[model samples]
Target: MPQMAPLYWLYLFIFFLLTLLLFFMVNYFIKPFDNISSVSHDTKIIYKSWKL
Candidate 1:
């Protein structure tokens, strides 16, 4: 098998880092929406308790 060059390894590393960054960015954006939905659901439950 042919050995890969150092530049190719650098490119791979950069690609991996970018992939990780993109994953975190998506997670960050999504996490707030999830939290908001959960918070709203919890508040509904709390309101029901207050009415009881």
Candidate 2:
């Protein structure tokens, strides 16, 4: 392979970091049902507090 310049190294590093972040984000959203339950619970609590 030809020698890589400074810009190429920077681009490679950024691409790698973004892929890692994407993996974490996908893992979080992969289970939408769990998130829905937790979100609903928070909403219910807020609504109950408002009634007081």
The estimated TM-scores of all candidates read 0.57, 0.48
The parts of candidate 1 lying over 4 Å away from their true place are 1-4, 32-52
Task: Report backbone clashes per prediction.
Answer: 0, 0
Per-residue accuracy of model 1 over 1-52 as CA lDDT, tens digit each: 2476877889999999999999999987776666667867776644455674
Which residue pairs overlap in candidate 1's backbone? Answer: none
The TM-score measured for candidate 2 stands at 0.48
Q: Give me the runs in candidate 2 sitting further than 4 Å from their true place.
A: 1-4, 32-52
For model 2, give the RMSD to the true fold: 5.7
Give each prediction's root-mean-square deviation over alpha carbons: 4.8, 5.7
- Please give the range of 10 consecutive residues that has the lowest summed lDDT in model 1: 43-52
Residues 1-52, candidate 2: write the lDDT tens digits.
4576777999999999999999999988788677668977776644465675
Every candidate's lDDT: 0.80, 0.82
